[model samples]
Target: MAQIDYIYSAHSAYAYLGALRLYEICKAHDVVLRHKPVLLSPVVEAAGGLPFAQRSQAHVDYFFGREIERWAEWRDLPVISCRPTFHDNPLELPNGVIITAQEAGLDADAVSFAILQAHWRDDADIADHQTLHALMEGLGLDADALLEVALSPDVQEIHRRNTEEAMEVPVFGSPTYVLDDDPFYGQDRLDMLERALSKPFAASNWSNPPVDIKAGS
Candidate 1:
């Protein structure tokens, strides 16, 4: 079976938007989806993208605020009008997802969408254990056992490793699918990713261009 390194933050809107489609595609293609939930901050910074908080309102409106509307309608996903109540909260729930995938050996695909729904639709605070536990229980999973493993230092370390790997690779945004070292970033590129899966594309011949500079005239 072909493998993909699926990298994203657990609470990311884009990740939520593409999660189900990506999973279905992989299942259809006999592919393995190894979900690697990561710390999105350092990775975005390394890739020279602005944080959501720091971006201008117009940028957020178009890229994030509005894109959410367009994609939710297009993808038939439910979403609240406002941003997730705890969207900017610390990443324990994000790490919990990685831990769930690693220590519990559960499908991160299911857990990922659940958490995303909890935050994005139900307006729950994913940083809260109650919310996480409730979401896990909803899936008929052993919430206690999963949470125990998810909170362990070993699993946390695994998540840290994932974040470090993401930063080093410069995966700029959420929902990045890497197949054979070729990265397709964003939910918008998923169709392209599906195409690439069907038939690998020719490698790009483009190279980094020389920097242009000029002294004050």
Candidate 2:
């Protein structure tokens, strides 16, 4: 079986934008998707990209402005015009809880998509414990038990390992798919990802293809 390693930030708008389509692709092709939630700030810094706050105003505006609107419409995912209410806070808690769920024999895709929807669509604060508990309950999972494991040393270690792997891959942003040795960044590159995953042994190169962000929109 082929593996699709998904390296993303829980709070990334891009990840939120790409979540559903990625899920569909995995389901259709029977791909094994691994959710690796890493801190985007450090990954971007390590890859020589500026943090969100440090980036030029033009870039920030483009990201939080028309780009988001266009992609949100294209992907048909709900999103706020501005950043989400809890955008500033880290989503490690809920993300860690999802990781715990995965370790506890829960379907990772189900838990990951649920977490993303809770934040992006429902406008829920993923950093809030109660919100996470509610999400767990909604998933028919034991909220208290999962919350306990979410803070456990074992889950924390898994999260740390995910971060380390993301750093080693030199991933610069969210929604990154690493198949074999090639890295496909951005949600729009999912089509190319699907093609690659379906033919893992093929000798085609798609890493860093010329991407026209405005053309598709």
Candidate 3:
């Protein structure tokens, strides 16, 4: 079976946008999707890319203006026009919960997607402990128990390791998939991801194709 390593930030808008479709693609391809939640700020710093807050105005404007809208529309995913009300807050609670879920041997994809939906679709404050508990419970997960595990030092180290590993890679953004060492860097590159999955061992170091908004961005 092919291993699809999905390295992403838990609070990433792009990851939230592509979560469901990526899940479907993995299912169809019979690939094992390994979800690695990392800290985007650290990864970007290591990759020599500026954080979203520090990016040039042109980049930020393009991201908030056209890129998000076009991708959301193309993917048929619902997204808020402006940033979420709690976008500035830290995401440790929710991300820790995901790491805890993985430690508990649950399907990381289901838990991660649930957390993403809570933030992006439901507009829930993922940084809140109660919100995290509710999200886990809704997914039939043991909220109380998972919360205990979420605070474990071991689980925290896993998140740390994820971030460290991400920093070693050339990935500068979220929802980056590493299939057989090939990195596909965006949600819009799902078609290429599918092709890579279909030929797991094929030698290809493909990057994200430039999105043409008018021509199906």
RMSD of each: 2.3, 5.5, 6.0
Taken over the whole model, the C-alpha lDDT of each candidate is 0.83, 0.81, 0.82
Off by over 4 Å in 3: 200-217
Tens-digit lDDT string for candidate 3 (123-161): 778888898888888888889998887767888788888
lDDT of 1 by residue, 62-167 (tens): 8878899999999999999987777888886556655676556776778888888777888888888887888888888888788777767777888889888887
How do the predictions measure up, each by TM-score? 0.93, 0.88, 0.88
Q: Tell me the deviation in Å of residue 40 in model 2.
A: 1.5
Select the stronger candidate by lDDT from 1 and 2: 1
Q: What TM-score does model 1 achieve against the real structure? A: 0.93
CA lDDT for candidate 3: 0.82
Instruction: For residue 191, give model 1's deviation from the true position in Å.
Output: 0.7
Poorest stretch of ten by lDDT in candidate 1: 208-217
Evaluated with lDDT, which candidate comes out highest? 1
Q: Quote the positional error of residue 176 for candidate 2 in Å.
A: 0.6
